[model samples]
Target: MIQPDLVELVALRGAAHDIALHARKPVLARLQGAHRSAQRGRGLEFEEVRLYTPGDDARNIDWRVTARRGQAHTKLFREERERPVWIVADLHVGLYFGSRLQLKSALLLRAAAILAWVATMDGDRLGAVISDANNQVSIFPPRSREAGVLPVLEGLVQAQPKQPGEESFNNLNKLLTTLKPLLQPGSLVLVLSDFSALDDNSETLLANISLHNDIRLIGLVDPLEYTGLPDGSYRAGLPGRLWWLDGNRTRRLWQEKWAARKKYVDDMANRLNLPVIRLDTANPVTEALPQLLREPSWQI
Candidate 1:
């Protein structure tokens, strides 16, 4: 049987569903950044009129239509534009394993797939920088239509962890440092990772990237990492070293480590004011991601 740890292209392609994420107009993406487009005037063509929502621009309110309708309406516009969305899937060696339904790597890639689908469906371009163990990095430049999304999906499947967890040589700091230059000011970036090893250096790199682009951190979490093992003795260790997780007493220490990891993410998000979507391996990310994206709770 094919384990859920493996990335399935067929399943990913099918994961694309009609995701309507609009406040008033059909936005290419709901992930808004600080970099606003400079060009204005005749370039903006009128698209339609729709009922005003909380986030809709007050300047766009149609006063004439508002009086007749008894409720506020806003004008929506369609400009000759598309957003560039970049996804960084960190399938480092550490994310290879899961005691739940899917591996952390698999869940991360699935979130990547859904974001690619959602962005492309709304007429945005897609690109990616996918990293794996052994220092393999697959970089795809932004492209529209299937040209943009297919290559990313293929790259994600290729980089999916082949086995259980192990020490990783992949460096997120170096990757983000190198990636910061390539990102356009207004680009939407999704970074999918477990991020258990992020330190002060890594946090600085991410903060620099967030300064220009709209970044969403998608955290890949497996239930076992926080829950620990059932009440039983288990042998666990690295390739050359071995240790035993014997009882509930030892398991508390295991769970405490995960708690620390959680706090690290929370602190980073709070400091950077970045939106975070935690995708658990136990839950189907394909379902959870869409709802998470649509919620106002994650809006910064």
Candidate 2:
């Protein structure tokens, strides 16, 4: 993968392009904000209510109404009018190889940078988790300050793939377990992965999270990663191997098997209500940036 600084620069440029030209029409739905007015309790429209937990903001309390009702009524407004996005990036070793201009992981970093920039630019808090294992997770609690994006970028740049045996036995599930407590209603989660390691339990965890947060998938790939050499002929330095997969387990080179797995992943994303932003390892991220910035399927 390219260095983090390079990916960060590319992302900043892409985000600027989207913000300047795309405006409210960015291809990514999570960049868009949904309005939630302050609480007046006039009708049945959903109101945002945070339980009167310790350290709750006192200024938000509806004191006048509380005095009238003769009970403590902490005010709950509609959900925040600002956008808040959570990004989960996979640094698994599988994404480290690419047959194109950049590594698959590099492309993911660029995509994440764009997301981070857009969310922060829209005055929304941006939180991210760089998960390679249970112990290697880096979490930045949501915050709206523009400066809040730095930590996420830094984490991405600094991240390294988990060492052998250092990798989590259940990376996605472990990450989700940690994520559940931090998430609140109406959060947005963007997961960037090759979808190579997802299992049944991990899928369920993701589905559960989607009930409260908008979850989208950015599935990364390289042409050579899927379709083996054309004409079924072998050549030196053809490309990297898919060691973690089944067909490739026999130390054989084959693209057909990789294609089958890729198709399965695409189908799974569709079934999970996760929209995919496909990335070609050989192409410039700018080529795909415009499509990614387009309206999402749900928006359509």
Candidate 3:
């Protein structure tokens, strides 16, 4: 596999042409704003808190106020052209396994690169949280795309384990817990992970964050993980720590675990009412991401 370094990220610039920031259609757009939208839905800026009305998104409801005043209220937002975009880059261990095409780590790196390009080109502020092996680094400074995004790209490559299963086990719950305090109410967070280490705490954290911010889950998946291995001896797992899946029992067990993982993610997303974008490791992330962002539901 080609190294997921700065050069690779730079090459992904062409993949995000149609990726536009979600903006509230401002009555008067700023002279030097990001992208502005004439059509309106749930854009970025927090406009005001008003009584919950029909057709209002319940996700934006302020639960604390509702409890105190014994009346439902909603947080309203006008789109901020230069919205803050946060990417949760999961470079934890166990991501180096990919049977076909590139590994999960590469897919994530490319996806993050594409997103950074889209945000920077459109003038949206870009930040990132990169996690690996029980540690995480947050890039939350205001910077030009070159200044801010380059570090994130570098972090993505550096945080990943030298090889898969190298003991880099950063739990999703831990990462999200740390990330909660850093995010603003109207920020957009794209959690790019395989959901391999999610727990009940992770679900709670995700729900809590989504209450005040727009959260999207992007699951990086590999076909081999879900499908049982074909009839033949095949080496799998990390380099220097390889294992063979020549037996039917092992493949079956792997398939079962993967199915459960997929189910849990789906159930969690449904419970939280969050949008999820699942990208196959077999496909080109550059090509797929642009198409995914254009979908109406993903316009956010």
Candidate 4:
């Protein structure tokens, strides 16, 4: 199969546009429009008219409507601006493996790129935090411009997966801890990862982050990771050195581990009240992404 490249990833802008056209779905609506701020203040758009109450501001009274109906009425307004959107993508060694369409790294990058484009199209500022084994890079919130999505996509293109032995250095929790301060309240935060690296501390930090921000977790996995291998010996490994999986027992154990990891992630996300969308490498991102968006749980 052809490997995904920067050009392909960058083209997700158009894919996002296509997805937005299907706005009957709540998730698509959220992705395609300016996010309504929870706080109502000045500079908001008129939402509706309601019967005036004791505490209603007199200045907000709709005199014409009140005079017509002969009853006091007040205007309600909706926050008119879009909030910043942050994409946090994991580039650890664990994401480098895939048995099908694309590597987990590629899928994560593609998903991030698509969301970045959607956020930009909806008139929101875009930011990103990308982490590998020993390094974390951040692109501060940048106003959406014609080419706003390019920088984040470029970073993904340039990122290299961590070496096998360097897995211990994958400190996603530290990266997230440092990122927490930078996120503005009410911002939308999308974390794309296999989430196999999360520990107790990471879960705590994620929960804390969710308290102030809208957090969505996208879990990337390969078919092999979810389904056990067939009953047979198979050779696998890097170029210089190789190893063999001798029997079905080993495959079952591997599948059990993957299932446990998936459960851990699911349970943690549930505790944090985070919405998670699972993406598989067995299918093309274009196909997999829309399916995820269509899910009822994809809504805020």
Q: Give every collision pair in model 1.
A: none
Candidate 1 has what TM-score?
0.77
List where candidate 2 sits over 4 angstroms from the true fold: 10-14, 19-79, 133-135, 162-169, 230-253, 298-300
Misplaced by over 4 Å in model 4 are 18-33, 38-80, 162-165, 237-242
**Residue-pair clashes per candidate, as listed?**
0, 4, 2, 0
Task: List ranges where model 3 is wrong by over 4 Å.
Answer: 23-81, 133-138, 142-144, 166-169, 234-244
Write one digit per residue (lDDT tens) for candidate 2, span 1-300. Answer: 454574455447444454411234434454434333211111223475433556777877767767777665666654355545788888766666677688777787887887777677656678887875334677888877566677888787777442223334455566676787788666667788777777777778888887766777778888876665444334342135322334333234565578677777777777887776777877777667656666545231
Residue 111, model 4: Cα distance from true site in angstroms: 1.2
* Candidates 2 and 4 compared by TM-score, better number: 4
Candidate 1: worst-modelled 10 consecutive residues by lDDT: 33-42
For every candidate, C-alpha RMSD to the true structure in Å: 11.0, 7.8, 9.5, 8.0
Residue-wise C-alpha lDDT for candidate 3, range 102-184, written one tens digit per residue: 88888888888898888888776788888874456555553566777788788887876555455544456667877888876
Candidate of highest lDDT: 3
lDDT (Cα, tens digit) per residue for candidate 1, span 89-206: 7878888777777777777777787788777876777888888775577788888888998888888777876865556644576567667887866677788888876888888888
lDDT of each: 0.74, 0.65, 0.77, 0.74
Q: Candidate 4 — which pairs collide?
A: none
